[model samples]
Target: MLRNIPPLLSPDLLYSLRAMGHGDEIVIADANFPGSSIGPTCIRADGSTASEVLQAVLTVMPLDSFVPDPALTMQVVGDAEAIPEAVTDFQRIIDQVADNPARVQSLERFAFYERAADAFTIVQTGERRLYGNIILKKGVIV
Candidate 1:
């Protein structure tokens, strides 16, 4: 175990985060997400919830400040104006970790998928709640 490092972050996971450049995104997905089928570059945080994974990542990784919203969560289907409880928890977690706490933007289902596909890497979590997924952009250490 490494000192000051969240044990949840594996060497591979840390490697991915370290390799990512500013403005690159990393998706934290729900258990039901088709993470495997989506692409080859994915890290599995199985048995862990997405919020917990986000907290762990945010402990080390910085949030991108260039974008309007560094955090993007999947919007509830059939509802654009409303946010699901799952998303509320996600926003709370972000507020807990990030100093700036980028606004959590809602994306259409298809748009969320497209964003995840473009991410530098996807970390699949074992969150059972529907729509409990989000993408976070990487920022510089400074």
Candidate 2:
């Protein structure tokens, strides 16, 4: 067990995060996400919820300050204005960890999937909530 690292971050997840350079994006996907089929390298956090995984990741990883929105969540289908409970939880976690907490951006379902497919890596979590998926852009350690 590492001293300061969140236990939820497995060795593989840590490695993936470390290997990712500035601007590379990672997807924190819900259980329903088609992680393997979408194509990016996938990591499994099978027993944990998306919120739990996000909190653990934000504890060590820095969010991109260069972008207006480094954090994004999948918008509820047919209701772009709708904010699900998971998104709220994700926003709260981001606000707590990031120095400049940017407003969470919303992406259309298919758009989100396309982005996730192009992500540097996708971490699949056990979160059961609808629209629980989120994407995070990695930043420099400065």
Candidate 3:
């Protein structure tokens, strides 16, 4: 076991995160997300909530400083302004972990899905909450 690494992050997930370059994105998906068919490498964090996964990932990966919105969440259908509980947890985690505070933007459902499909990897969590998925772009270590 490695010191300081979140146990929820399995070897494969850690490897994927390490492999990603600046600007590459990773998705922390809910139980309902269609991760397997999303066309990117997928990692299973079964039994972990999306908030847990997001926190673990952010512990090691820095949020992109070059983008206006390095963090993106899926908007609730028909309620673009609605913020789900899981997303609120995400924002709190970002505030605590990110080097610079980053704003979490809401994307239309399909647009979020399309972005996930293009991510470097998707870590599917067991969170049962609606709209628990979040995408994070990697930032430079400097």
- lDDT against the true structure, per candidate, is 0.88, 0.92, 0.93
Model 3 lDDT-worst window of ten:
97-106
Candidates 1 and 3 compared by TM-score, better number: 3
Residues 26-71, candidate 3: write the lDDT tens digits.
9999999999998998898888999988888888999999989999
**Arranged by lDDT, best first:** 3, 2, 1
Runs with alpha carbons beyond 4 Å of true place in candidate 3: none
TM-score (all chains, Cα) for each model? 0.96, 0.97, 0.98
lDDT of 2 by residue, 1-142 (tens): 9899999999999999999999999999999999989999999999999999999988888899999889989989889999999999999989998665778998999999998899999999999999999999998896
Q: Comparing candidate 1 with candidate 2, which one achieves the higher lDDT? A: 2
Alpha-carbon RMSD to native, per candidate: 1.0, 0.8, 0.7
Cα lDDT for residue 81, candidate 3? 98
lDDT of 1 by residue, 1-142 (tens): 8899999998889999999999989999999998878863889999898988999999988898888889998888898778877789988888888856877998999999988888999999999989989999998777
- The 10-residue segment with the lowest total lDDT in model 1: 33-42
Alpha-carbon error at 141 in model 1, in Å?
A: 1.5
